[model samples]
Target: MAILDNTSLQLPKENPGAEDFLPLLGTDHVELYVGNAKQAAHYYISAWGFQPLAYAGLETGLKDKVSYVLQQDKIRLVLTSPLRSGGPINKHIDAHGDGVKAIALWVDDATKSHHETTKRGADSYLEPKTLKDKDGEVVLSGIHTYGETVHIFVERSNYNGVFLPGYISWNPHYKAPEVGLKYIDHMVGNVGWNEMDKWCRFYEKVMGFAQLISFDDKDISTEYTALMSKVMSNGNGRIKFPINEPAEGRKKSQIEEYIEFYNGAGVQHMAMATDNIIETVTALKNRGIEFLTVPASYYEDVLDRVGEIDEDLMPLKELSILIDRDDEGYLLQIFTKPILDRPTMFIEIIQRKGAKSFGKGNFKALFEAIEREQESRGTL
Candidate 1:
């Protein structure tokens, strides 16, 4: 139950003598099970500024489902939908509307990664399989994590196709301006009540991650709600997951609402990294992206708490962007309203100057903003 003040912020440390059995290169792609892949793909292309990369559907010889791949820099998103009723994709979409299904991780050897994690008590989601085409071959395997979300291990060193073996190059005439999004910074998961530590241990013992930092109800509470979080990171620092659970409070917390609507533990938000947050946020806003906003009074004393920063205070305040400083440096970030209809999944735009820590200084303002949104929806 340590409070993370600006002066006391610390980065995650690797576990002592922990062997890196599951060596992951980075995130390959994030797949979402939507209701319609074509329209969803158009939304991502027109609104989020993701470029079309590849496709696989009836034309590609698949009958049950269709997938559309989009890319922006190093970030890739795969949107899949069921072509027929009564399939798993339809069931997943029925349960959780347009949510992430697989968080694919890039690895050097998918077979070895699956063997190591499965031997460490992980539930097997997909066995080791090799997909081959004219370009090359790609090996893949998977393991179940919290809830229905699965982590797919992708080894594509031998593959040079557009995306995978079955997918073909998708070149569409419609294009949008790039938004300067670099890569996935981190993904946050919301578990049921008092289940944060269970998944934290799952990441530590099963996937070889170490505790980064922790925040309790005392550290992350408002007048009406509270939540606790513990961050876990891989040995190479390429992946980070912060597990959150609801704490006792005066009313419903955001984590509780997410769990109730999502029907189980799932990813709450994905934080995307940008080198120029001001420009990126501006483009996003121009494209009709709505963000959560705090009161003007919150900015009055923000500089006094965070000290001087490189960016001008007026622009950050104008866009309602939040700023926080760790021992290393400061970071600029902002959260979008739930993109989906269920108030479940959202996106975070962040730019790191040198800071490695999450925005502990801006928790109160951010949560208060979230509470305002919840109240409007009558869920708070």
Candidate 2:
């Protein structure tokens, strides 16, 4: 499948200001530090239907680490593992387990992005470095964000090779058919207590983002758990990040549990956009992907709550999908159970019809579903 075209899409009007200095094309890739890249690659391939795209390791002359790049449309995932015992990759895995390390962004000029961000008070993670191969050259730079997560600016307009200079095109005999997933809709981060606004401001000041929306604990809480979130988006709305923090609740909040298990702040979920949520989610479900399911009662008066939508109510009710509406339009969304054993990271499948809002209307039902899972796991 080809990448989904988002050029014509329009978000809810919130004129933050003109974004000029740090222009982001879109999300290039999300890199995760894992214990075993090979097994992780297989899991994603078999379960999530990601096609192996590129690889870098001992065969590619990388002695310290190995990375497997998987792609499905515009969504790319780089699973990296340490080859040796004492490298920085190993240290990150030890500290955070298999979690996101980098949210690579596609930019026009890596050097200019780095300079502009650093000048705006961002901490440098990596200086601009150009990697060249026979195909072409790619310029890269990085800046530190919340926790140990880094945003790597990738300028690959000049490069034509497979991925970076070091990675080679990976074509295994075994390849999984792609799911209907098109691209990343948004990535949510779980920060510590009272840290959502801090990171939200960081995105605004350093990366030229705007506050899309803010949700307090009252807006997104069940009886047991609570958290606050603030959505931040890039100038052109190509990238969005909702920073969340644990809030005072009767029991442990989901963000607090993520912080405890992940050992610190990190990405909670990546909301993937699909043209048809019914087909995409059906494919995932058949492939053994477990989703957080709401009760059947949620379907009884759903249409009365959100008003008329294009989709039939039966399939949605059968599939346990959730729906929400805003002034713009309605959106259909579903969340997968934690993909890893640690219960830290997960994925959300979202189909936005004309709505720009982040399913705020479905918070109570969704969080209640999550709380049920937490109860089963004894985490809440």
Candidate 3:
């Protein structure tokens, strides 16, 4: 009996990399720890246009946590929350608010990644272990990241389980249609003050990642707050992780608030790629997802800056989407407000016309917009 008989998710396509930084096999799934899995799952499906994929909870025999899996194209999110009070999930909720807990990576070999990173001083969160059920078996290992965040290495080459051993196929009565979200472009992590380089070095030495892009205070600074960032990519460029550290500026930053609530460095936002930002965002907005509102004035000069675009500028202006152009091409990007109550994590919706670069031009405007939100929250 195969785990993925015929009605299962597809396996990741393997991309071979050198021993260094094991050019990320790909994103397996993103697991977010929310205060309520059921509500969060609803929010994702209703607002973000993600369709329910799989589930594990009391019915499946899991006593401690409930996880709802959602998917759009290759991007999958596992929303997990504690079913009871006074547990690790509660502690995490109280400390960090609702945020990403695990950025699981698809790998060919779990034990090798675990041993290599552990030997290089990575804190072990879970020892290399195998999980098996009637469907199939999966080998998994994990390591602690900033705060309570974790990087789970999933070796499913030999496993065909629905999701994992415990998770059964989720055939929901209601289904939300996909909104053209293809895959994760990059996942950004926010570290504490003056710690971006430390983690960058960790990835460089431990995982053999190279700095693909870097932004100093000058580049990312706004009127009230500022932060620095460096993008790290595996050899194949399939997996890109950007590390962010708050810079000493006039006022407190969004990154600082994340560190305060999250209690340390953790994932701030997961950038999802869409082939059509206008269509996707429009669908998302109609579905009830509220994006961060920027002023119309920001659009006055967008065309002049990014040159001509295929999208109608009027609609983009109405939606407050920011556009940026690089040598290769252009991109449209917008962000949502903190989906949780604590002002911690947010979502970024981006569409690449041809450019592979993060929106450097929009950083200042985006940060200023964020500062305004911080002002409203009395965080600054």
Better model by TM-score, 2 or 3?
2
Winner of 1 and 3 under TM-score: 1
* Stretches of candidate 1 exceeding 4 Å from the true structure: 1-18
CA lDDT of each prediction against the hidden true structure: 0.90, 0.90, 0.83
Ranking by TM-score: 2, 1, 3
TM-scores for the candidates: 0.95, 0.96, 0.92
> Any idea what lDDT model 3 has?
0.83
lDDT per residue as tens, model 1, 1-380: 11111121133434443345677667889999999899999988888899999999999999999999999988899999999999789989888888999999988889999999999999999999999999999899999999899999998888777889999989999989889988999999999987999999999888888888899999899999999999888876778899999999999999999998998999999999999999999999999999999888878999998899888988888899999999989999999999999989999999999898999999999999999999999999
Looking at model 2, which ten-residue stretch has the lowest summed lDDT? Answer: 4-13
Of 1 and 3, the candidate ahead on lDDT is 1
Please give the TM-score that candidate 1 achieves against the real structure.
0.95
Candidate 2 structure quality by residue, lDDT tens digits, 99-193: 99999998888999999999999999999999999988989999999999999999987777778899999999998888888899999999998
Clashes of each: 0, 0, 1
